[model samples]
Target chain A: MHLYRYEENPLITPNDVPPHHDGFEVIGAFNAGVAKFQGEVLLLLRVAERPMSDDPNIVKAPVWNPETGKVDVYEFRKDDPRYDFSDPRVIKEAGAERFLYLTSLSYLRLARSQDGRRFTIDDRPFVYPSNELETFGIEDPRITYIDGTYYIYFSAVSPKGVGEAMVSTTDFRTVTHHGMIFAPENKDVLIFPEKINGKYYALHRPVPRSNGRPEVWIAESENLLHWGNHRFLFGLREGKWDSARIGGGAVPIKTEHGWLELYHGASDDHRYCMGAVLLDLNDPAKVIARSERPLVEPEADYEVNGFFGRVVFSCGALVDGDVVKMYYGAADTSMACVELKLDEILDSLVKV
Target chain B: MHLYRYEENPLITPNDVPPHHDGFEVIGAFNAGVAKFQGEVLLLLRVAERPMSDDPNIVKAPVWNPETGKVDVYEFRKDDPRYDFSDPRVIKEAGAERFLYLTSLSYLRLARSQDGRRFTIDDRPFVYPSNELETFGIEDPRITYIDGTYYIYFSAVSPKGVGEAMVSTTDFRTVTHHGMIFAPENKDVLIFPEKINGKYYALHRPVPRSNGRPEVWIAESENLLHWGNHRFLFGLREGKWDSARIGGGAVPIKTEHGWLELYHGASDDHRYCMGAVLLDLNDPAKVIARSERPLVEPEADYEVNGFFGRVVFSCGALVDGDVVKMYYGAADTSMACVELKLDEILDSLVKV
Candidate 1:
């Protein structure tokens, strides 16, 4: 279970990132992917920014133009019946076909830490919206080092839906995008550190139109582009903290027992928490033991304040002997860290 | 504008179609496609049927099995909050991805008419859902006869989404399915009677998730299987009866003025009505003139009382001299007929 929080709990905040060139404010910098590349600990942080407007009725979002390769602002008025703004983070258009658009823009930023606690942030963004497919923005990156290649998997947002795209980088500066690895209505795609039984495996969440159940699924790939033999990994537990939905977090850590996976789960009331799931090493699709209780929920003021409240979302973590260092987003507004003893987490996992 | 209604307002009702072999009840038979073959007029009717359940809390929809060649029922509990039953015809599953399922089973039936007013209904269904793609049953068939072949276009529904499919037949009894002419999130397809500029053109409706608009689109085909060269035909008008959504009706009727299209439109309040649009003869995508008002709304008791109230939607219309005989569905429950003088409708169209 996640126990001790760092002395300086709020590791990263909105003020850490520079303001937008278009007079926008940095809303948050959280949900960072922890990685150790080239003898230095790296954090790929998801930085959310919102445009500044004089009128209270107007809301703006960054719209990507495929033709000119530029991001333009799309404005929607509050009084318009065509749009429904029930949620602060999302705006739903009213008509025959439903479309949900986020109010803010999210892009990845880089940060480096020597002690894995104190970090130095980069001024420039690591990734931003480029094509019409990424009209909304890229978000929530999870890095996996496989065959000397760091496969940075992130959610690609567009009008169609949230899909998973991967960019591979040997050196941190330059990366090659492999395009959309997962189709629309899918998110939280995480690749394993190594191949399982001579095949690449990934954990993804598909929001099925039927049943309305967004469950975590495992899929095997021969070329990584073409994925098949999908297997249902696990589903939400009724009358539990994770009764709504679940997604994979961080690359799976290999152990004698199984592949230890730290995952994020949300309750019906939208309270997010972390949990551990142990998968069979050979057959990663097989669910072994799952946490009966949340590893950590929003208990601190920083975890329950600003933007969306009552949230603790982990993007990635680093394994060091029996200790697991987790870098997570708090309240969807800022970044924080917590340490979990690897053996203690493995012991806490119980069969449901 | 829908000047006269047939004395027998509801030409075909639940009593007309045979009940399911499994003690189910026939709900309604409406939205018939019109065609004149072998000196006799025929109407392809979409007959909706459902199982008579003892429990009021349980809702059931008939699902067709391609392998078994039989219809099986799918049930949902009313107590589950996952269902959005606000719309009487469609029950939407709520969550990340939205899916709308019909409450009744619809199958096409053959009805022959001598006077075009009184129709003799057949006991057996002419066309039923025969594939996994059509598990939700076929609906809203529009017929276009070209080169001695009748192309029947209808909306096919399943767990995936609603799509457009077609069947070609020389003899009405024998039909050859072309298999999903248009992919999911699309329907209401009406093919043209002849090739336009050496290419086959079809009118379709695609629900774009980006804009939340379900607008009518025109697409051309070279081999009928491969479709391309798509053009936006028209969309919903604000503060109007057709403000919610619109779809193509009968095949384009060529006139000296232009090619006249009779289409169905629904308002946000779920009021369905018929409308007219005039398109350029050579370039069918170019909208020349449109009716400022709906041709007909729910007026008569037959069109006012049924499964879905306040609906008068047409699938096909036949032209004989200056009289346009329109066959339409009433209240989404029963079939009816109305006649309009060609000169009157043409004069009614405004350039706005």
Candidate 2:
């Protein structure tokens, strides 16, 4: 498949987004949800920030303490046998059953582009962590515009476990927060732009504990608050690019062929790539077809080397005419954009 | 405080309940939910059965296959490096992120008793694995008699994850399944017998992936199917008898002073015991008091040795006057009974 990468790729970096506090530094500004409003393209970016430590033996972790209602930093000695810092992204307690703490905290920030490439970032965060469920932080925002409202769905992370939560805003100035719509150990939730068969439908990835890999599951809701009628939509393919795990990406675009869904999948080696799946337009649960190979791989230098390497994850995309404008997070560090033809993606999908 | 153990301590054992099939053996007949129905005491017992293999090198795991709609046995070599069988209850995959499969499949069976001590076991399962969510099995039932219906809440285990599911019955003949009431990584959900302030309340333990330990959480529901208004009720007290992890046990018994709740807590050494928690009668979320020491410890031989040793877990109890007839699972192997005085138990709680 032929794809076009913008000349000035890596559209937004950590340096472009300011830290939330005085002692913190922005580590990542990526994994944005793309949307169009008021004749401008908007990217809701996930900005990750971490507290700085001067001592070589000490590492700091920021946590939202619900009791004191403030963000607190926990300092751990690198020499301590109890604290396992093997994973750069998290600080795990070394024991039989693991307890995890993020190395950095993440929240959503807004960026706008008139030309769909160059952009101006908002001074303040679009959405920040507030509740106990968001004690660790929030990550990965997906925007779905329906009627006159823009519904923003993101992953709420805490010691409680990662779950999906929603918020809504029309002008992007004020926000109305909706409490957690999904329980813990779940993320990558994307809502359909329009109701299907008179009910609101959503795609979610629930990470299993005992068995099963993370796969996309569909559920329908009445008021968009309480969700039910859960059915497993699809799972990982054997000996394929997405053999490890898979999740729902960009709000599925409606087409004559089917509901075109751009999704992210990982290999056994943790290499992330974007793939496509075609679901029946009327019945979103029915899978019509899916990609045999990745539509976008982590081949670019920006995508191959960053905070977390070998990843190209997209949460949102915008379709104009036959051109699909895809915004993805490169290596969990910086934001980048690419363009793919609608017909080319559709043709690439192997029939089930 | 003084307590009395029933003369026939283990009222039901694996020898009393027949295996589900030819090659299968009833490994466990415990963790039963006690209820007073008609003129007899009913025990909804979690009967665990596993396929027996004569080959000393092979371990068999029973799994409910969604595709075949049947229970299938998976055999793994004891010498296989990919499979880790160190944990007696579950088989874990050996590398990176682990996948788990149960050594035995569990389903609920019914046992009827004229007196609260001696019982007769049912021939068929009261409730068995039916859907994909319960592929692993259904376990640890907590029955609450509300109005005329008995609400049987259980932990539905699958590769998807362990979550709480509900089933209701007026007569023991048939049941109405209420899908999953709580999502994955959560279990030990106990619903109150009746509504308080026009809404139903339940206590649950959601095992966290990241930070928090498994603690008791209270949630209120309008329909009992969808829960909301979640609040952290209580957690483990450091250096106490109940320190490692805690979960709701028998349904809360409403009393004149408050609501008396029996909860199971595990120590750092994995010794399980039962403790008491007192909550506000009107608002169950409000903590009134809790036990500084355990009410029931694994001191008996049956409770100290079996499938899982040093465990005493209760799901249901019958409150007759000032006597609390508690039926508990001893070491995950047999059903046992004990009686505690309500006044003595209530006085043992240390005021919070």
Candidate 3:
């Protein structure tokens, strides 16, 4: 397997993007959904921000209150036995249900690049948490340019549940909310650019409470709204890189071999790596081949350390001739890119 | 305010209904969804059956295996620290996600009555746990007869999540599944018998994990398969008889004033009672009035004792002129009926 790492490795850092609100600060700028528009590559960057806090004993959780139309900070004392803030990303209340609050709220911000290298970040957020379903804020946007509309699907978190929502834009000016397509405890959904076998297909990772682990499942839809015929596609490899959980990464790229899908997998210790899965062209639910080893792992200095460490999560990618331009979130902090040869990736896959 | 208890109470008991499979016993036969078809009263009973395990240290959980099309038993040792069987109904695993498996699996069995008092329980299940979503079992069904078709909405539970699913039958011979109408962490859905203002209305209770308690919500649909425009209807009352959690019970009865809905409410200590809520005729989402006190509480010995004590949950009722024939599940073990005056219920509700 061959990977060409960019010299300007960490393309867009948290310092590159400014916060949407006054009291908030940019914590992470990564896991962007990408597309090509108007001769420039567009990145729907997941910009995470948090309230300015100095006290070590106090934990501040920022949430977009739909009633107030602004961000509200919920402060919890570290000494409180009712709340657990051991996980830096989420605050869990001590209960059977385990009420969760995010440490930082995320929004999708637009970033433009002419050569798919140097980027200019937007001042305002492209898509902010607007409804009660997204009160905890949105994260990990995956953009699929279908027909004339750019469909951006992201994880909408709230007390209701963690479900996937869709927002579409035709000219990058007006946006329309399509509500929640998939129900909660589910995320990392990627819609294919085109329909397969007369029905729209999507790859989703449903976090099961029991029986099975979090695995990639395929669903079919007629109007891209009401989905059914859910089938289990594939799961994590036991005692391997993806032994813990796995999810769909970038949208599947169509090639002569099959539908090539680059997916992210995590080990037991929460170390994320990217791998590939190839599916049958006609019946996308049928697995054809899969990656024996991860194509991209947390190896770079940027990937090894940041807001969160040892993670390389991809949301979108583009194929140019025989080269695949893949953009991923490193350490859950900043955006980065790596180029992979299509032929080499096809050869590396182990046939199912 | 007024209730006429049937003299021959506990209409259907576990002993009345025989087990479908060998080496199994009917533990509970309750929560019957009522309907009148061809001058006969029909009760879709939630019959819970479990394996006859004689060993006190061992617990056997029965699951409908779709692959083998047979009931499979999963045995767990009482001394196993990995599993918690203190609830007696559910076996929870020691994990953050809290994997759950039901102690006894339930399915809908048809019970026919000529006089709405004496009934004949079916030998086989009318609607069993067929799919993976209903692996844990289908419970608490609410039936609504609209345009010559009987629509039965019930809770489908599994490791995936607890969601509301729909099943329809015209003659009770052939059944059709409409898949999951609502996503996980949701149940207790009751569809109105008739459309309101050219749209179908449903009352559902979504179990929120973080912000709100389990509250009743209203949703509208055109095709009944895809639902949207979800709005919160009402929630639990503090320091009241119905304080813990509330959910829609039977199909709403349409009257001149409004649509009268009988609902079940539980206390913090798990004492279930029946209450009423009146909604506007044209706009069913608007609350007109609600019961200040429970119309039916756990008063009888059957309701106060059994498998699950102090529970009086209703699923269906029939309106005959000014008198309403209500069917309820007593203590999650047996079914019972009560006669309620329509005008008395409307008068008892406190205006909003």
Candidate 3 lDDT tens digits, A1-352:
7899899889999999878888889989999999999999988899999998889999999989999998889999999999877778888876544557889999999999999999998888889898877999999999888889899889988866677888899987779998777766668998988988788889887664434457887877766765655656887788889998899999999999899999999999999999999999999989999998899999999999998999999999999999999999999999999999999999999998
**What TM-score against the true fold does each predicted structure earn?**
0.60, 0.91, 0.91
Error of 3 at B192 (Å): 3.7
> Given candidate 2, what's the lDDT at residue A351?
89
* Number of the top-ranking candidate, with lDDT as the measure: 2
Q: Candidate 2 lDDT, tens digit per residue, B176-284?
A: 9877777666788999988999988899887655456678887776667666555568888889878988999999999999999999999999999999999999999
For model 1, residues B1-352, the per-residue Cα lDDT tens digits are: 4489989878888787787547688887888898999888899999888878999998776677778887777788887798876655667775434656677778899999888878898878888887766888889898999888998888877765566678889999899987666654566788878887887877877664434356777777655544534445788899988898898888889899888999989999888888899988898879999988988778899998898888898899999999999899998889899999999989999975
lDDT of 3 at B316: 96
For candidate 3 chain A, the 10 contiguous residues with the lowest summed lDDT are A205-214
Model 2 chain B: weakest 10-residue lDDT segment is B222-231
Tens-place lDDT digits, model 3, residues B206-318: 76443456778777767676565565688889888779889999889999999999999998899999999999999998999999999999999999999998999999999
Ranking by lDDT: 2, 3, 1
Candidate 1 lDDT for residue A210: 32
Give a tens-digit lDDT track for model 1, residues A1-352.
4498998889888888886546788898988887898778899999888887999999777666677766677789998998877677777866433456778888888989888887889888887775555778889999998777788878777765566777888888888877666644567888888888998888887664433356677776655554444445788889988898899887788889999888999999999999989999899978899999999889899898878989899989888899888889999888899998999999999974
Please report the candidate that would top DockQ against the real structure.
Answer: 2
Residue-wise C-alpha lDDT for candidate 2, range A7-61, written one tens digit per residue? 8889999998888767999999999988899999999999999998889898889
Query: Which residue pairs in candidate 3 have backbone atoms (N, alpha carbon, C) closer than 3 angstroms, thus clashing?
Result: none
